[model samples]
Target: MDWDKLRIFHAVAEAGSLTHAGDQLHLSQSAVSRQIRALEESLDTTLFRRHARGLILTEQGELLFEATRSMARRLETTAARIRDSEDEVFGDLRVTTTMGFGALWLAPRLPRLFERYPNLRLELMLEERIVDLPMREADLAIRMKEPSQADLIRRRIMEVRIRLYASRTYVEREGLPRTVEDLVSRRLIVQNPASPQVRAGGEFVQPLVAQANSTLTVNTYFGILQGVIHGVGIGSLPDYITAGFPDLVQVLPGLESAAIPVYLAYVQELRHNKRVCAFRDFVLEEITAHLRTIAPASE
Candidate 1:
């Protein structure tokens, strides 16, 4: 199989027009068409059918499309690894993390990472949205949810314990709740549910609060934590997030604690690549060691 012809076929299938594909690949439309024709000839099957607007993949093309997509991803990963190997381990390491984790945990610890690997350049992208790893949007991600993609590698870093907490001022003013029923009478700070399960939890938990009206509703957990810090209302926050805050008091200690698993995800094939591997192992070690230092004796 001619890799160049396959590349042209992939570009055409993706772009849906020879002209657009040619523009992207910096080749003439005629050259792109020729390559596609050669690929079809070699395969002895029609790959694409011409449409009024663009080209549509034929049934044969659909099968080839799947294989070609995988091939392209592998090729890109291989090329990136080759380029990385030739250069110093000093290139940018793009990381995506939730705002709370990045701000309270990862960001502070990054100085140590830099001290260890002085040559590695770090770019931290803090967001609530999970960046697309396979698209090369991010090199690594630390997320609350498990990645469902089979092509990506995922490791369970640790289980984060989330508990309802309030500032000392709020607790003193509102009076500490003796039971879950007491929560129903006080103001609550809540985060918008990122998943259906979290929404269900919110629905069940909200009824316990007396006011039912949340003082603040934000998309990110960090926002919820910040609101709690300013005496907004009782909010559920991860232990790791609140560990550094001196004034935050845990409310409903045992009843409100929920365990959420954290994960580290990256491209599967890039697992063996030197720089990627180094970062991956470094993160695992840092997070696991941190957990060990803070976790209860039983944990």
Candidate 2:
């Protein structure tokens, strides 16, 4: 029947009264009651039972309510998609990434994006927390972990290798750790000691002693690399961050290593947006081309 009648019926079912539904829909109370009456007549069923305070849904009304809710949700999603399509793509591109990668790698590369699209603005949120893309918390994100949800589209950018490193001065003073057992006694700068993934074997690398006895504890990879530069204790750092540093030497070259996959994620529906597509392709191209030069050879 009439969509407007169904709309009014849905509103009244939700609000429990004609007056309340009228207030919500910005219609007169009489208009709300008329629409509900028409809908009831069209359906040939008594949708609501009259009560002293308000109305209560009948069994048929309850069933209709569930179906109507689904319809409303689908309609709202479709309308939002249409509106987003009609909107211009010259707005800000909000991106979220880890602090270390954002600062050390992506921040420097953003100049090219700005140069290409002078009209678009870029806002970077550098935090470890994964921002919700479908909720519009962020337009895009570069994450170290693979996404578990199927609603978003994920593209693997590259395979990242973590290498243990120390400065030449530290190596000379503390003596280089030739074996994994030697690493246990030596000082180490850990990024996140609390992380289960950071543990090698049964012994956890204590950053406090590693800092006091050897170097320092830092949360970001950039900070760890800097600590290693100033002759801090040995630390594990991503290959991309330490690529150009002259003083940082690979510690325990073959014995100890961990590799993690990096991904570029975005909402599946937004993939077709012109600006989004352009940025996605550009990033994919850059990462694919540069990964060979920067990524460490797989062990």
Q: Estimate TM-scores for all models.
A: 0.63, 0.60
- For all candidates in order, the CA lDDT equals 0.78, 0.75
Which tens-of-lDDT digit does each residue in 1-299 have in candidate 2? Answer: 79888888899999999999999999999998888878889899989998998999999999989989999999997777557653334557888888877888787777887777676777889988877888989888887888776689898887666678899888778888777667656667766655334233113344224434444567677777777877767877777677656667788776444456788988988888767776787788777656765555432
Q: lDDT at 122 for candidate 1? A: 81
User: Number of the top candidate by TM-score?
Assistant: 1
Candidate 1 least-lDDT 10 residues: 195-204
| Candidate 2 accuracy as TM-score | 0.60
Each candidate's number of clashing pairs is: 5, 0
lDDT of 1 by residue, 164-264 (tens): 88999998888788887677666777766552233333653555543564455676677788889888888877777776776888887676445678889
Error of 2 at 188 (Å): 0.8
Q: List the candidate 1 regions with Cα displacement exceeding 4 Å.
A: 1-88, 193-204, 209-214, 297-299
User: Alpha carbon lDDT of residue 78, candidate 1?
Assistant: 74
